[model samples]
Target: MDNINVSDPPARITTITSKKLSAKRAQTRIQAFLDDFENRNSTLKGGDKTVTVQLQKLNQALLDESQKRRKSAGEGR
Candidate 1:
C-alpha cells in the first residue's frame, strides 16, 4: 500500500512493493492490498462519476507497473 492520497480528488494507488521479502510475504502483501482496493473501488464506482474515472486510471497504472516488473524480472532470469 503506497501513494494513498484520499484528500485529493482522483487519488492514486500504486503497486505494493516489498524490499528483500520472501515470495510468500510479497504475495500476501499484494493480495491484501488488492482485496482492500477492490472493496473501496466498488463503493467509489457506485457513488461518484469522477471518482470512478480516477479509479480506472489507477487501475491501469497498476496493470502497467505489474507488466513492467514482470518483464524486468524475466530479463534478469
Candidate 2:
C-alpha cells in the first residue's frame, strides 16, 4: 500500500502596503477635520453658503488626491 501525503495550501496574505496605507490615513484625517469643523459651527444660521463652498473645495482636493493615487497605482501594475 502506498501512503499519500497531503499538506495545507499556503495561507493567503493581505497587506495594505505603505503607500496605500498613507493615502488612507490622509483621507481619514481630512474627513475627520471636516467633520469636526462642521460640528463646531452647527448653530450658525445661513452658514450653508460658506460651508458649501468650503466643502466643494475640500471635495475637489480629495478627488484630486484620489485620482493621483489611482494613476500611480495603475502605473505600478
User: Which structure among the candidates has the greatest lDDT?
Assistant: 2
In order, the Cα lDDT scores of the candidates are: 0.65, 0.69
Clashing pairs in 1: none
Alpha carbon lDDT at 42, candidate 1: 80
Estimate, for each residue in 4-73, the C-alpha lDDT of model 2 and write its tens digit: 4557576799986645445446656767777787777675644555764676577667768888989999
Q: What TM-score does structure 1 among the candidates reach?
A: 0.40
Q: RMSD (Cα, Å) of candidate 2?
A: 19.4
TM-score, every prediction: 0.40, 0.40
lDDT of 2 at 2: 68
The lDDT of model 2 is 0.69
Those runs of model 1 whose alpha carbons end farther than 4 Å from true positions after fitting are 1-48
Evaluate residue 45 in candidate 2 and report its C-alpha lDDT on the 0 to 100 scale: 45
RMSD of every candidate to native, in Å, equals 9.4, 19.4
